[model samples]
Target: MTYLVNDSADFVDESIEGFVAANADLVRRVHGGVVRATRTPPGQVAVVIGGGSGHYPAFAGLVGQGLAHGAAMGNIFASPSAQQIYSVARAAASDAGVLLSFGNYAGDVLNFGIAEERLKADGIPCRCFAVTDDVCSGPADKAGERRGIAGDLTVFRAAALAAAEGKSLDAVHDFASHANDRTRSFGVAFSGCTLPGASEPLFTVPESRMGVGMGIHGEQGIEEVDMPRADDLADMLVDRLLGERPNDNQRAASPRVGVMLNGLGSVKYEELFVLYRRVSQRLEQAGLTVVQPEVGELVTSFEMAGVSLTLFWLDDALEAAWTAPATTPAYRRGGVPLEGEPRDADDFAAIHEQAAPPSSEASRSDAAGVLAVIEAIQARIEAEADDLGKLDAISGDGDHGIGMTTGTRAALAAARRAVEKGCGAGTVLTRAGDAWANEAGGTSGALWGLGLRCVGTAIGDSDSVAAAAVVQGIRDATDAIMRLGGADIGDKTMLDAMQPFANALAEQVEAGTCLREAWRHAAKHSEQAAAATAALKPRKGRAKNHSEKSVGHADPGAVSFAMIVASTATTLESIHEDVT
Candidate 1:
């Protein structure tokens, strides 16, 4: 269990603040995350890598000379927001362009992909690459769908090294992609990790047993087995990786490989060294030359009793990058040559809120209604946060409850501020959406943010809100979510409820039902749809990695969506009753 924390909600922010203060010489705090203390040289590609917090040295710790130019930090076990990624990239990019790299998780893919689009729209060159290197997550034929684990170290190093060598953006991206293709990792956990202020760990393993194919984000392992001796575990890991050797390296003359025996938080360095001794022997017996094998913590979960072994099949270029000098807060190679001057104090950009658009008296009245509904949603989420988190833990990283609570709280605050400014319902929702995305920073956050924005745009600031307008807004939001999330109605996601709710509302509105009556009917459809998800297997997100475990459990996202819509229906009915 995490022992040192003051207000679990403020944990990530406080940790980042303290980390920057401790490593001020190498890293500087930016609006969204951290960047190298020194500026990037002109005409050199800037490599930015990131994901959720809690994976210590992987992100912030790797931002310095000969490594990542910056890192966009996110909430624990969540992806950084698109705005966060964009801010970090803008702060780090040079004339050559920027290369964004991260794990191939669903949240990371969506957020980083959006950031890449934004960079291009602003006339800044950018390319994003998702590292898929964990063999346990997918089959060899579908390697592109695998999750990235400790093997991310190899890909990040390749891109950063190429950038440091003054390579162009394309070249840096290619190097990173190549490294990702050659890298393969497998992990195991003896026990799960507990989040800050949580009463229990995310998952538990049987005594004298180990969970195999575990993820770094507090997800339960795919399989369970009796714990093995140190040497036996080493043999098992080495043999598994050897079976996954890149096709090109299968017959190479004196093939070289870079190894990283990464500890996933609480595992001691002494234990790793003991395991590495046997790993080294096995590699030598296989006639493979190991180059600069790293044996310690690199990418870690918060105090997870787990370890992962990454085998980076090295070619000439990869080997050179592997051996290149690097200097960062937590990692360093040989001596590194300093090139650029210290970063300018004025480089960190400040965010300012935009003025609210003018609104009519009738529109202001509608805004009040919007605020009331958001307040109800926030309360419902807070009341059900623990249950939602436990439900998600069956197959996911168990951060859904935290994400929903944070997003809704921020959205509610933004809505209230907008109401004070006399904004219309549409403008209020737009501001709320922005706040939700910026604070929550994950797949659900991005989806809810986008959906809210779409609905707001569809329902313009008119004198009165009509049932037809509400139905249209629901349809627009549902469409946008489906497009962005790449999930269909039966994917065991929030869409399972959202689609049915939208359809039911549209039908009732077309039948001339009152807005309150239509909404109440729609809420029932959503609730029923959410409940139906228990019989379906998840086909997206972290839960997809353990589809079997997800059976008989509704998606946390679907349940939360149902809860919000149901509560909003009550709020609408109460408002109508008070007006009458």
Candidate 2:
């Protein structure tokens, strides 16, 4: 469906490239994403908002005066890597601090949270606020767990306005959180969206039917009903959002509200205006005074034939912030007085990589085995990529397979480069992990990347990797995943398979088994653990919203982890033969 793409994997990058070129006066390219062309006043809180790349205007388009200072763009429907977020934040942070805001998605939260910690360690004040505005993602009591949709515009604007007003980092963060609390959104889709180079849509709706409560990603709606006319659909969205209005707006005689009727990609502005006509009439009848309501595509999902409506209940402070002047390439308001000069060429800095550590001869020999294992993993992922995508499509955005392939390919290339540099197994793995995380850009990518880094840390470059070291590395990697991802054994994530594999490998190694035999034994347990996920409901990630849909299917992440371990076991067998 994406007719203009050269390669599916390069779509996001190419799009960002062209976007920066077109809006050179408004924005400039950065290592991870984009920043304002002009400099910000020193010591002012910088607002950096981002998520995946499919949503246009949302992240990159919102970067300008009185808006986001920068954005960290990710792969298609994937969250940006922690390194990407960190890079963007570092570029955007002023003397005061940096405030990171994004939609409430698993990968975004994990990656951004990690970036926040990294920034803090660098002595930069940083805080993260995840926008949870979709009313359909969860019940009112669990609103904090809801996914963010088009309502991101309201929250991002509020936070950016506070930052533009020279508020402290704490004040900017509070304003963002308050804006999130007061916002609610609901959406419906007539059809699903297709990723670049994909033959089919992510999900489909029957003719004359509409999917209710659709997500911005390729996630299917929670429910479906017969399609209705424009006015009827408007009523549905308005009534749903009004039912979940913030508590403070419930008793107001005439509450003023900010409205956003966002078209998800393909929906035309004419159609949106028709829908907003009824939406406005209904709000007026409900005794709510509408403020400057936005009626267009603020956030999109490629070419999804859907639309979402957001209601931002405005307090006096919120209204002032909402009405503030803003100048961006996509979204513009009243003209803003420019005080800052044009950005100089030297303002952009390159992201530098550390040199690989030295390795002993024995450790370098071990590095060859690591490279072989990574090659085997990549081959296995390439073979099973389609099936993995199908499994993920049951409950998720269905990009896991593509992400794995991208990450593994990057990992293999990085491992080869490290080996050529005479690095040890640990350094090779560490570089590979960094490459994977930097390229993949998703929840699975972040977890696997950090997990590999942890394993590499446990196995130092200076020494030969022994069975005991391997066991310790697995244990450390498992623990790191649990800590970073916040998922346990039964969460239906990669941890389900990885944790079992780690435990089994440790038991076998402690029982005096050789590394190759122990790994083979652990692989079986991982296979069984991955399959066992079919009986459990997902308690985390985007899949949680559609848990019932995935009841009979194994988790894609768990299955992929098991497959990787099994493939690595075969590589270990080959290594054993060579050593013997």
Candidate 3:
């Protein structure tokens, strides 16, 4: 993989140097890998934070006027050396002394523990708190051992505020520790990520499957499960969080929750917001008052396809600290402060607009044959999902199988319901398209949805989809796919299969061949076209990275497209024979 660095060993230093250079006015690099903001308030208790690199904004990014007094930096995914941690502790001390805050990881604990002992020996007065917020990382009985994820932000913010408020060093430590206790996080990854200049990813999940409880460093998760819709994923995460509902049975008190929808890295903002909408809805349903929900890359791995959820049980002290105005390079609350606003009113409507509307047409069975064919296609994909994912993994993000399976399953379910309702092929396809859009939720989803919608438009009310109509449908679907995905035939995508199928169907129609014969011809052409994609280097889409490795492997998207066309062809041939 291409990397933006001079050397893997120097990656951390280069990045921190650049960071300090950019924010030199607000931050100054100290002796022990610590970046201290020059404008720390006088005589205040100092707040020090540290963590591994790559998860930016956690340790260094939080250093500013109202946040950390100083931050210690570690190498990517590796804990800072003990000497580095001690240096940061020495630099961040005030008359009230310093409080060291960092995530709960083995390396971090060992290094930071050494730093704490060294500092105490020198009579500098230092204490330490660890953020153990990731619920997925450890069992309930051992939650204290769980690695901290995005919850580091909440812990740091609380500690910073306590220090800024003239609290004693011990008090600041207590507040930060309290914040850590209240926070919990869980994460899922669709794909693994590579370290800078590394040729291989740290770990990988099969296509159409998610790694539940995945850590930030590409660690194998607790389980692998079939990927679900955005709403379902959000629900699962929220349920796990709410299931451990903090005991608030004391004295008539309402529970307040603070949510952070954090992107691991390289996940588009649009996809993140889709998840945020669902997360907010689930939290509301759980009867928790969500205050000032945060969404974005608060903490991130290096371009990993994953997201983590952090929920903090809010209290007066923590809530006050959370709402306190703070500025950092990655996190800032510059807008109207979230405090004093009616807590019940969540402004998520703008974000929730991405969920497409359902089909207006009622379901029906006039398209039973078409529905059967779609189901067959769906079954084929489900059966071959693992194989396809393996193929795609050679050159792509290994999601083609999952994307195809997800889109087809949704399409089949909708089509089956339409058939039961006696709907025509057009209505079935249109409804299936709508369902695909609502369930799949990605660039591939939009493409498949458009393709189905266009095909539906071409086959409107036809008792049998004729060869000419099938040709037109393929043309329409191809056009829509192109418009949505901007991929062409040689891009090693489904377009390779689709374009050939459409052209062959048109030729058969011109020659006045039987629908069965035309379909057979189209399916044959589609299979060949799909195989041909193996020879064509990918110029776009996720497969661009392994274009050479992909040369001998059929494009998963193309292979699936051919399979669908073949299934449809076979089903239509049976129906034609019955009619004759």
Candidate 4:
């Protein structure tokens, strides 16, 4: 089915805009995301959850006084950037720190990790708990490496409810982590979904087949098999989930559980009810009492033809939270006490109107040069986005190309404005990085923003530009990326290319090479490093789910970095030749 949208490129922003417009009573717009319209108590911990835009109730639809305090939405199938996460957290800040929660995908980890660091640096303590509940993604021994699907709801609800109960940050994190450990989910898809503007679905299943154990980001199932009858599907899901109850709960006698039969997208409500009927009968037969069973689309991929079942093993505390009142746009439970009377929020829109500081004439001229580099990078990103997305689709959610294209175009627009305004190198880069992070909203976007800002800080607006300065900037950016992303050189991230480039550039420049010549030499090392990633197993990001299948495919981040650097080096060399 074709989606009704005004502009394909404006889909995410417009969707968020419409969400805020319709849910004004429960949520309000913030700088980089949305927050609850009603304020929380002064000392209450804020639970903020987020990810890509395609998952509905998991993010914006759940922002309310008793559920998530805020949500940072990103482009479809991409993780929200660090800047977006931080802004949403800041809008929801209180005397108590923030508890940032999301699915345990690679992009979410990187972006949320950066936001947590920034929040702490700004005098607000923060903690992150990533949900890992997809049973088919990994074995119980390695659950931490699994991808999160519908289980994001159970974990987020537990944390948000604990926070609403005035629990400490530690308690919030504990409860969320506890919920993740206790929750298990399994899913099967009959067909894939198409993005808003896409002509076809991300992937397809045979007419007589079904995709088993799938992710929420339009990712195809791990294994395909013959389609089964509705009752057979229910039995299969219940048996598998019950077979591997959390280690601690497996020993409990008559363990009560909260059952959720979720529809991904295209699966109708009546269909879910039919499945739930069989599921409930099986649980009863197994001597497990179902507490507060739910059958609905709590989280979804865009029009995906699939369904998933989540079993949240309930204890005294978990059951209490499960029944706790929650009020949001798409979900509402018992009457939750409202924090405050709904109020007008006319003052929150000032976050986008920041002014860049003045800089020297030479620095402003250099900023114009940086703008050219950004344009070249944007062009390359646009040309290769589809290929990059295809690489990511092999194991990831398949939005890398879109994220990169959107982020680079945004960065170029910002840098051009800064250059015209007579800004310095640092100011130009800072503005561009912020724009990139906010627009792209993914793991690569957040890290790239951090790296750019680090480089900008090292190359001060007041300093003289030289080979030493550029080397220092590259080294600084590399370190910041490592610190923020928690990935070493072999983790198959953008850092794989970044580290080698910095090293080569530093060595060449120290030995009296000009900036352009040194840059060309460094770009060679970056390209080689990017290509070498094909042989390594991914330990981080979405690719980790299919660790073995990811072998022989160079990471998209590493590949993009090599292209940007190589292109920039060529532009610089041509400029040098003209000047001579």
Candidate 5:
């Protein structure tokens, strides 16, 4: 449990501040994350790695002379926003190119992919390679569907080495992709990691049981089994990893591989030592030549009592890269010549500011109503937070409720502030969206942010809001969500409820129905759609790995969407009556 924090809300930000202070010589602070303190050689490929904040050395500690050029840190257990990633990338970008690497999680994919797009559009050469290495997350045929875990370090190290070799962007990307393909990992957890401020753990394992195939984010495991001895545990890790060796590596009679026995968090070096001993003996017996073996915490999950084993089946290039000289705050090998004094924390290479869009008094009048609707949703989400979190924990990390509540509360506050400032409807929503995205920090947060921003775009400030405009706004929000999140209506996400709501709203508005009546009708579709998602399987995100476990539960995102829209319909009806 994370018991030593001052405030749960302040933990991540405060920790980041302390990290930069402690590693002043190795890294400097950018708005989103940290970059190397020393200047990158001109035309060097800046390898940027990142994800959520809790994992220590795997991300920020890897940013130095030889590993990642920078890292885009997000909230604890949440992926960074696109803005955050873009900011870090801009800080780290050089004339050569930018290579963005992160684990293959839904929020990380959306945020990092968005950053890549923006970087390219800005005329900076950039590419992203998401690491997929956890063998338990998917079958060999669907390897890309696996979540990246401890094996992320191997992929990042190999990519950074290729970049250090001054390889072209294409070459670096290919190197990282190959490293990801050849790598495999499996983990077991004795206990769930408790997030900051939470009294109880996310989930619990029986006192004598262990969770097998667990994720880094406190996600549900594939199965539970009686706890075994250290040697037995080592065997479990090695056998599972060895069973899924890359198809290309089958040709080698004795394949050379990189091995990592990683402690997830609270597990000490003494315990890890016990596990790694047998791991080494068994691999050699299985005709595998273990190259440089790492037996310590490489990636962690916020004090989780767990460990994961990673194997990177190495080719010639991978072996050379794996043994390359590197220097970082947490992990280091060989020597790097000192250039000069490290850069100041306040020093920045590039910074960009976005201005608010224009709004008129007419739309500003409508914003008051928007604020009321948002407040209604916020209250509803607050009421159902525990239930939503429980549902999400069945397959996901159980943060959906917390993330949604944080986002809605932030949105509500922002909307209220905008109303006080006499902002237009579009401006109110735009500010609210930005606040939610910034505060919540997750896949759902990003999608909701996009949805609100697109809605604001369609409902411009100059014009008085009309039925057609409202319908257009709803359609635009739906389209933006689909474009950004890559989820179809049947994917058991917010889109499951959103699409039905949009269709019903548009159809009713077109039929000359009153706005309140139309919204009520549309809300019913959303509620029904949300309920129907219980029978469907999750096709994307972290939940996909434990899809079977969530069979009889409604999607948290879908449920939240339905509940919010239903409440909003009631608010609209109240507003209509008041206006009448």
Candidate 6:
């Protein structure tokens, strides 16, 4: 049974309670679920925002100095009731009046509309602005039907500045609407997410695949496709966004662009950077100058592994507001540039040029063992691609299954060629790592390649790997992974399995066990250790938000590594028996 808190009914209030408790200096809970910034000066145009509870920083966290003046918090994945919106509006209003900003959704529209009536009846001047920037959410022919994604940030910034400048409600509303019209967003999700206090996720996605146009609430997407490399995925998202460029044929000659790389909760900052590099490269290649690009977790779904790309066609007015100094917990500007061109071309070229070449002195027997291990791992990954993808959907980018399968297949082919050419085991492993790194091109590729090289280095010139050699090799590989990724044991990573396996092998080797027997013991211990990771809260990696939920799921990397080791040990044993 899935472990989850069944507190959905109280999720909204409880979350707000925590939010207010932590941000008491910046904001105060007024009436209903409305939170208003204590720093909002009177007589300024008040900007009020509202949405569901899960998308923090959207409708609630944005309420602070230089941000939203007030926010109406809603239930998890549900729109706030009209009464809540009305309460927020009344609390935030001044002589200049209040401007309501929110994402475009049916429930939000219905509820906010009712609130608008109540606010007007109470003699509060109010206007509404809805953000509908997701190009993938709606058909091109009916752009109005698109849902809002990350573009809400741009809309809120414009409205808040207009209000801060003491403009009337009408002026702030107009500016917000204009920002919404100019902005466009597209997103892809590898997995789905569970609402607070829910036993199951709201939806499910297949393994080795991604759902384009997925909504923040686990809504179905336009289509699912085989998971591609970061560059390929970035290209697809950027191309779609560029295709929807507002027909400025008659309006402006050179349109500056503002890009926001939004993480959907589960993706790590490092992985996001990998994706951002591709995005900036694509934008530069398209001849569109990015005035300023925002990266990080500005918008998110609760631990959902996805990313959204937002492009705002900037004018002088909007650019001024965007570039204006602002401070918040999650969003910031003017510290260090998060995205930029490569600083050193020479360093970049050196790193890229370190590809491994085919080996020169591998024997047939050694080659066979390596090939067997590669084939077994590849076959397993292909077979479980869907399952891995599904599991990842719950807490990470769902492409683990597909990414591993594709990479293993490529690595296997490289290994086979190296073996056929009589290369040594080390050379074969090096070539395989290089092939996987170049062809697969993602977090997993770099990791798997590093592991292969580690193993190859430990094996050195051994005709047959002994239990001690294998354990040392795995230790070396683990060290490489930790060095490259900065992930340690209990981080819900493959190291959970690897550490235990290495220890078990070392113990068995010390006890005078045969290589095959030691492997059996290690694989068994590794499986238990992998399963044990389900109880660990993720301290690192992309699934940091849902660290709690990731407790019960085995680390995908660990499981795969165990399988490869077990297969190799068994194959080597069989070869020994044949020789005897």
TM-score of each: 0.89, 0.92, 0.57, 0.92, 0.88, 0.56
Across 33-112, the per-residue lDDT of candidate 3 in tens digits comes to: 54455434456777888877788866788877667877877656655645566666666666677788888764566456
The lowest-lDDT stretch of 10 consecutive residues in candidate 2 is 571-580
Candidate 1 overall lDDT versus native: 0.87
C-alpha lDDT (0 to 100) for residue 119 of candidate 3: 78
Deviation from native of the Cα of residue 86 in model 6, angstroms = 1.0
Error (Å) of candidate 4 at residue 466 is 4.3
- lDDT against the true structure, per candidate, is 0.87, 0.87, 0.73, 0.84, 0.84, 0.72
Per-prediction count of colliding residue pairs?
Answer: 0, 0, 8, 1, 0, 6
- After superposition, which runs of candidate 4 have C-alpha atoms over 4 Å from their true positions? 249-252, 341-343, 383-399, 534-539, 543-554, 571-580
Worst 10 residues of 5 by lDDT: 571-580
Q: What is the lDDT of residue 532 in candidate 3?
A: 91
Cα-lDDT of candidate 2? 0.87
Of models 1 and 5, which has the larger TM-score? 1
What is candidate 6's lDDT per residue for 215-273, written digit by digit as tens? 88766578899998999999999999999988755245556789999898888789889
- True-structure lDDT of candidate 4: 0.84
lDDT of 4 at 151: 82
**Which of candidates 1 and 5 is the stronger one according to lDDT?**
1
Candidate 4 lDDT for residue 131: 90
lDDT of 6 at 164: 74
* lDDT (tens digit, per residue) of candidate 2 on 427-516: 888888878987998898888788778788777687777778778888987886787677898889999999889999999988988889
TM-score ranking, best first: 4, 2, 1, 5, 3, 6
